[model samples]
Target: MDVEKLTKALQWRGFTVERFATAAEAADWMDQAIDGVSVGFGGCLTAEQMGLYPRLSAHNRCFWHWQGDSRDDASRSDVYITSVNALAETGELINIDGTGNRVGATLWGPKEVYFVVGRNKVAPDFDAALWRARNVAAPKNAQRLKRKTPCAVRGDRCYDCKSPERICRGLVVLWEKPTAFEKMTVVLIDEDLGL
Candidate 1:
């Protein structure tokens, strides 16, 4: 992947991009960046892989519904942290969310939003990014959740199934930084961290 090109594109599109050699380094940077702030976490495997919940919770009021915390409260936090399913090198971010909370918070209602993206999530272009989200990320997520969706059981690409257990009901493509947000940062990690 052309990391430099991607970083330049993201910057041109008004996103603050920070590249890290590893997820741990990025997590450490995040821990310091959001110190003393009220932080909220969306359902992000990347964040979990980085061990951010415990690190952030030590210094910030961090809420993650995946840990049985209140989703409503997390949505209203001072800052929102999450990961996208795919990030286009051309500067588009693709995310598939089962519930609207993750995408909703990403769109608005936060002072700042931080996206923790691993190198494996980057795609060559927008179409490829969307494809990655649907075919790769979605299936892996469904399998991880132990859902009975066709994608999970079939062990292949998305069938666009009508199963109620589908975790990809909402698709979001963030081409530019939201005008309502005070800041939007994309932390790019070198290692592959999550599905």
Candidate 2:
């Protein structure tokens, strides 16, 4: 991946970009940077890989629906952290959410929003990013959740099925940093951390 180009593009779109050599370094930085605050997390496999919840929870009040916490509880947090399904090297972030709580939190409510993206999540352009989000990330996530969707059963790509268990109900594309958010940071990791 052209890290320099991606970083420039993201910065041009008004996002602060931080590049890391490894997920461990990124996680360590996150742990120290977000100290003494209320941090909320969206359902992110990348964060889990980095062990962010336990690390961040050491110094911050951390909440996540994955831990049986309510989305409403997380919404009131001081900072929100999550990972996107796909990131366009041309400066776009794509995510598919079942409930919209994750996307909604990224858009508003939190004082700061941090996206912890892995190299595998980066695509060449917006279209490719969207495709990755649907075909790559969504299917894997569906399979992981044991959803009855065609994508999960097939264990291949997205069929855009209308199953009630479908998790890809909402699509969000962030082409630029949200003005309403007090701060937005994108941490680019070299390792392939998640789906």
Candidate 3:
């Protein structure tokens, strides 16, 4: 996708955008981005796999995760920082997670949210973002976690099913930039970061 177009569209949708040259720079900013944040992480291999989490972890307290391995404490900290998978050009965030930790935290518990997205996660519109979440994001995650979801078996797209193990159950879209905190920054990197 065209990064400039995507960035412009996101900006119009109400997020403050910062362009980074590389994933390293993105990770660096995330580390120094804030303080005392109750960070919540979605199942983003890009952030975790790229080694961004450790650096961000060093800065402040991570929120208590309702799912995934409980690595950080959630009660003491008031501020929150985290990343999600999908973002539309119109400035809406779309996320699909199995255990609900990713979407759950963003919905109600965070003081602020920071989404670190690479060029790959940008879609033309909200519907396109949803398509990417199901077809591109979900199945790849299923394969990574070794789940038996239909998309995992088909390796094509999401059916939006009633399966108990369906990862796409809780989808949250932030159409307006959140004003709950001092800042809600969406750092846009030119590189490919998440699925």
Candidate 4:
């Protein structure tokens, strides 16, 4: 991936971009950058991969529904951290949510938002990015959550099925840093960290 080009594209769109060679580096940087604040998480495998919760929680009041905290508590926190399903090199960020909490917070809730992205999630363009979100990320997430959707059963691409367990119900595309937020930062890591 063209890290410099992607960085420029993200920067041009008003997002503060931070590049790192590894997930651990990014996580460590974030742990130090944010302190004593209530931090919330959107269902993020990337953060899990980096062992982020424990690192951040040592100093920050962190909430994650995946770890027994309420989703509402997460949404109401001072900062929100999550990963994108797909990131277009053109600078658009894409996320497919089964529950609205993740995308919803990105749109308006937090004082600041941080997206932790790995190289695997970056696509060449908008079309490729959306395709990755729908086909690659969504299906993998279904399997992880054991949702029993067609995509999960098939262990492949998305069927765009009508199954009630479908995890692709809500799609959010960030063309730029959202207007209401104080800031949105994109933490780009070069390794393959998550699905």
Flag clash pairs in model 1: none
Off by over 4 Å in 4: none
Question: How many steric overlaps does candidate 3 have?
Answer: 2
Clashes of 2: 0
User: Using alpha carbons, what is the TM-score of model 2?
Assistant: 0.98
By lDDT, the best candidate is 4
What C-alpha lDDT, on a 0 to 100 scale, does residue 60 get in candidate 4? 94
Clashes of each: 0, 0, 2, 0
- In candidate 4, the residue pairs with backbone N, CA or C atoms under 3 Å apart (3 or more residues apart, or in different chains) clash, namely none
Location of the lowest summed lDDT over 10 successive residues in candidate 1 = 66-75
- C-alpha local distance difference test of each model: 0.93, 0.92, 0.69, 0.94
lDDT of 4 by residue, 1-195 (tens): 888899999999999999999888998899899899999999999999999899999999999999999999999889999999999999999999989999999998889999999999999999999999999999999999999899999987999899988888899999999899999999999999889
> Where is model 3 poorest over a 10-residue stretch in terms of lDDT?
71-80
Model 4: lDDT equals: 0.94
> Model 2: residues >4 Å from true position, as ranges?
none
User: Against the hidden reference, what TM-scores do the models get?
Assistant: 0.98, 0.98, 0.83, 0.98
Off by over 4 Å in 1: none
